[model samples]
Target chain A: MTGPVLTVRDRGGQRVATLSLGGLARRAGIVGAALVVDLAVLSSAPGTPWWPGIVVLTLALVAAEVPDSQAPLLTLAVAAGWWLAAVPWPAPSPGRVLLVALALLVLHATTAVAAIGPPGRVAEARVVRAAAGRAALVGTGTTGIGALALAADGRVVVPGAVGVALLAVAGLAWAATRPTRQ
Target chain B: MSGWHPTHAHLRAVVAGFGLLVAGLVLGRVDAIVLATPLLLVALAGAQSRPSVVPVLEGPQGALAVHEGEDVVWSATISGLPAGGSVAALHPGQRWLEVEPETGQVVAADDGLATTSIGLRPTRWGWRTLGAPAVTGYDAWAAWRWVADRPQPLRLTVLPSTEQPDTTAPAPHPYGLVGQERAVRLGEGTELAKVRPFEPGDRLRRIHWPTSARTGTLHVTATHADEDAHVVLLLDAVNDVGSSGGLVGERSSMDLAVRAAAVLAEHFLRRGDRVGLRVFGDWRVSFLPSSSGRHQLRRLLNVLSVVEPGTARGEDALAARQGLGAGTLAILLSPLVEPASTQQVAMLTSAGIEVIVVDTLPAELVTGDRGRSPEEQLAWRLRMLQRRLERDRMASLGIPVVTWTGPHSIDKVLRDLARRSATPRLVRR
Candidate 1:
């Protein structure tokens, strides 16, 4: 968004005037992830109005450029909301859910990478690769979750109880990960 | 840095995951629950991988002393980062320092340690302080972040870049006993002066056989003494006119003055001449006494590197008090923009010290650029006229002025001075 510049400001407000090939590549990666997210949402809902997807894509662009801002979170929320509203609710397939989930995961991971440093930072290849590996792990887990949900669609004795148990597990994980203050 | 704090990305993941899960349960939508699964897993993994120990950051690494236009690396390393944790460093830009990657930002994963570096090339000489590198650590998932304490900025003394001027011109007034220049005084030396009648205390080997036989008397050969010249470089640092664009770009008045002084000092020192330096308009009134050898050259350059213009403008009397020897060749390097500098030249000439003025004002500044307004242009024209008048005055006083044009620039002027020195003339006391 700032265009390909020889210099840019870092998070510490210092003017980083060194141009880097690795930095440019990282910026491209961020934009690419956002584009993929937009495409996946659009493909998931065939007949839905494209305006909502376009709006999410715009937010995604903002997020890619300014990862430290609230734009990235807002973009994710808008994207997920669009997918839910556009896709047919009860008849949504496992493969479609997995596809959208994978796309969102990529977008989130890339935005996180960009957020680690200043807008002009050249994110290390190893760091990016590690993020991808983490995303893949999450993607695989999501697919398994979806498969289990499909298998238990009518076979489970108490579906509500099963949902409650899943929620409790999610809550526990969140509590365990919360940062402890000094 | 304090203990790791949750980043916005982590919060985004948690909120999205929890929101989607609650929505799925409320609407009985299996697709929504499935979508929430990935977000939840990412958030949980991020939490698990959160760095516990504060990363230890060290450096900006590299040499603290270098010459102008020399390339050096400025870098910082962060250690103790957890596996998969990353570090981001930003080294800001500063004037006269050219950094590679224009944007001095770098991110590296902790593979035992991460070192962020930028190639630094100084454009000009002086004491320079490089911007301190700011490092921040992030967990593999970028879920947690911590910033290292800012360290002291790197300071370096950039020695003035010396230009090797190809000048074999001998100094007009060589005085001391040991040197390459032929002195006017009669002494024990190799070159023949004349075969005259032998005098008392004359060595037996000095007798000229053919001349002795022809004159019917013992005759002796006399030769000019080989002695060294004392060169005192006087720098005019009253005002540094024009903007310096570093080594490759347009040079400022001070840049030219300092560099020219450096070249002259090196030349004289290499020739076994005692070279000295006096910085006029410096508050400290820095003066290096004339001495010979390569060590003296280093000391002279070190002194030149610290010259700051307009530092002692009020101390005109102190700046003028340069204690030069009788036969010392004082090379005054100045832009000649100020009246005080011209006065100093007149004072040295009056003291019977041989002085040569090297005009160090850049040509572009002398030839007015079109960017200036009419009034500015007029003022500059008037200034030039005044400068020309001063130069004419110095010239009439038998002092030669030459513009610095790199190698052999002052050779012609020095040759003329040497010829003039041979002839007798009235010199002011």
Candidate 2:
């Protein structure tokens, strides 16, 4: 009656900056695995022994360091830039790997949080389900293209051609069918 | 309102997305563009999403106003929508004019839900103010946190049954308002309308004998005028109904006070008298100077419904509680639990407002566990105490106290108060 009752307001989630060290290690491992059967580059340049592995390792670490959403874009730019700028050497095969998968993954990830309902609450199951569904369908299409290119070239293409195809497909699809309803 | 809780779908999505991000870097997943694009897009979109809330008001019963004792069909409506949203009206008081959830159309019946558009039914003859409609929208389907709403404060006054009209009380001061009006105007009445029925006491000179005899019945055509008996009904919401409260709704003392106010207001209105109300609790009682007919009844009932109780000191209430115009009778209803309130009533009567206190107290409650041994003694002592206090208080003021003790007691109390009113003024003090 005398003064207004003071009730404390609730603060939501806490913000965390950047990636943790564990995340970096995980990225490094993924990149190393991708290079396991990839002997095309190594086979062409006989003199370069551990250098190719080292480069892949470095790329993987850097890519992992990039946040999930930005990771794909940055990886595309960095990987393409690195391969183009590098000194010319006889390479066994182009790296068509990881491109389509990465592109689809980015597309899928964006749709994950793109919801149309009330604000502040967590993303709804329907949105998540739709996003996940789309991601699966997209991931299959994108990665399948790269795999096809890989088989055809007998080596993973550098600056992944599969990624280019996936990007074109996703972009076309997105532009063609922008949802009319919110 | 209905809301969703965090489910496995959410966790799974997070897992798959994060797994790819980590896998992309470690395995150098598809070209860098493939994995990185989706992650970045998702993150950006998620970040861009804003959270908001919609407010809604719901009520019991259909959108139309309802009276007490009637069946209630309550419903709720939501407002302040979130995107791609869904709402479920929960609880028994959910009355929707229509129920079409797929199209996102759910109407609620109630009032005061500010965030939501209000839908209500006047369930009783008092103001029906509803709490905010329960509505919580989420950014996505996930109901991360629910926001409790402040009531969309609404007021729907339910006027009591036809007001009886308080034509009985005489209004001397506050010029324009005097006594209850009739068709044939009286020299002492307020307004002059018409003359129809003739009584035995008709002045011989004033009679229209030819018209009366021709009509076969002794008749005097009367006129209609604006007149009223100014009576103030003071409500005491701080009452106790009984151990279990009252009627299935657990109405409590406050309910009695409200109903009493409604009935009294109706009575005063019907008699074509000016009536006002004075509520005691959370909000100050209302005052409408004496007026006549059905309109005044509507106004009084409306005020009764919205009259909130306040914490004004007993004495402060005492001053404003009785809106008197010299001869206005103050019909007060209180439980008289506290001495402060009773003292104030005594003071009002002393100041000349004809005070009549209706003790709307709760019935005494004691289960089998409560010993019956001292019942007689306790009753005797309580009665003695009440009498002593009441007698002492009335001795100094021209007022009477009526106790609504049990079933079938209202009529008796009304008669008692009426008789007391007829007593000589000096003798009353």
Candidate 3:
């Protein structure tokens, strides 16, 4: 008998992803739902153009069918679409902005869940619930930040200080999540 | 265990958050930053809350041995998970080791340890490898996962269920040793043999008082000696006919043969008879010398477990007959598909080895079409008829053939052989 040895590698600090045909179908459903939310967020925003929403929806739908390795690109594209649509608007309300952001987060989270584990395996209830809980907390924080910015009338401008602070925070986030070589 | 690492989801969140934050600040669009804060904060929280210690997986343990149709629970535990706890999934290697609900999921405990139980059922008798279960541990947010390093492989040995045969038979021949079977020689034993006039060397305890009183002379009671028998189980593993649906479905010829051999071995061994096993087939031929005790029974079953059907040449029959011991009752378990086995039975019987053949061929093989064409069915029928003739030929040589039907399968044949053993017979040199 040999001593215990771990054979699986911890690359990307992610669960070994499985892409079963059933999981792919489930992911497609999730993407479709996210698109409907995107459309709703875009249609509800004042003076927001419909073309960006259509483009985001189309890209997300197509991305849903792509292999998991390339599927993340679609998530980025969809987020970009929402950002572009909101950018041209004359200062949309914080509530509408927060809604669109939450929707995008949901899309990304669902894709992540769907992409992980072996194919044909459904995500465990606890895993899904825990992820949802995390996403919700993030959504709440985003809402709170949006509320603060709205309260200040989007005019709390401290250019140099904010940039330095943002860079520091981003650096910390990157360091925290980065895989530590054993 | 490897240290924590950010998953693709975490990275994606970080990128989306940072891009929006930088873009919003540069373009002077407060809405973009507002949209980005949530993603950023979530990533930050996940990153900051990286589990302090990697979870160690404990086991895939419990009930390593089980009966057929019984369930064995294989479990593993993960400890040292963060507050959000972890989710562990089990992937048992064998397809027959069916997992309950078919979803291998278990949530971690509040103490940061999670145990997952998977149910496994063995369908057949043998040593089976239940390959190592791959355990993947996901953190609270499912953002990062720590997989257990190499898990140990597990093996399960399934022992055949020993069904006791109801009917009993006298041993054809007994070795002159103390045991359960009564021998022809008179000695001090429980079974009364005779009452005779006491000789001067007779002990006082041997005197039969009533006989002494009636005859006015001392008489001694004599009893038959108890001795053991040598039982040789000759298993013909040359060919298997019909499909085996494991323990539940229709038994193949090999299944029947093995199970019957096991039952016979257990029965004789329990009665203090020295039992041996000899398997002849296309594969490896295994032979065990006659021995008595629980250990020998275990050894016999282990040998029988690995028996598989092999291509039988005429030489195998002669080799099998040669393996039998003198004055031993040789029980041949076979489907009798090959003519070689029939010839072996005839040779053993003619050599005065007291052979009995238990027919293990499933009746369906001869009757059921089983999707065979008319011409194929006709050929099968013809082959079965020839097999019948061969069986009859063995009977003519004084080898009784019986079909295995659980208990009482060999009782009548054994009884007949015992009766015939009383008469003197010539042993071929």
Point to the candidate with the largest TM-score. 1
As a TM-score, model 1 comes out at: 0.86
Cα lDDT tens digits, model 1, B210-237, are 9889989999898888888988888988
Question: In order, what lDDT does every prediction score?
Answer: 0.78, 0.44, 0.70
Tens-digit lDDT string for candidate 2 (A16-135): 232323223334344543354224334434454546456654554454443233343333333333332231322234342354234335322432232222212222244445545545
Best by lDDT: 1
Task: State residue B206's C-alpha deviation in candidate 2, in Å.
Answer: 10
- Candidate 1 regions off by >4 Å? A1-49, A91-93, A147-182, B60-63, B105-111, B186-224, B314-321, B370-372
**lDDT (Cα, 0-100) at A8 in candidate 3:** 33
Report iRMS values in order.
Answer: 2.4, 11.6, 3.1
lDDT of 3 by residue, B1-429 (tens): 565655666666677777777777777677777767766776676676676677777875432555455677776777777676555565654433555524354454566766767667776666677767767765665567676775776677766667888867877888748678888788767889999999988789989999999999989998888888999998888777887766776788988888898899999989899999888874554688989999999888877776667654444457766656667889989998888787887778767788889999988876666436888778777888898888888878777899887758788887898888889977775
The runs of at least 3 residues in candidate 2 whose Cα sits more than 4 Å from the true structure, single-residue gaps closed, are A1-182, B1-227, B236-255, B278-310, B314-327, B340-356, B364-429
Model 2 lDDT, residue A108, Cα = 29
Predicted candidate 1 versus true structure: per-residue lDDT over A1-182, tens digit per residue = 12345655685435645455654655566566556656666676677887876787788778877888778889888878877787776544567667777777777877887788776666556666777787788778877878888667656655475567477667757665666444
Say which prediction, candidate 1 or candidate 2, comes out ahead on TM-score.
1
Candidate closer to the true structure by lDDT (higher is better), 2 or 3: 3
> Against the true structure, candidate 3 has what lDDT?
0.70
RMSD, model 3, all Cα superposed?
A: 6.9
Candidate 2 local lDDT, B1-429, one digit each (tens): 333233222332333334444444454433333334443333323323323333343434322344544443333454444454333332212221121121121221123122223223333344545443444333332323234353343333444433233334333322244444332234544353455667888665546678778887676644444445567777765433333222333334555566666666666556555677766564455456656677777666666655554444443555554346445667777766555567767666656666667666544421112235698657645754774576566645545665554323344444554556545564122
* Candidate 3 similarity to native, TM-score: 0.80
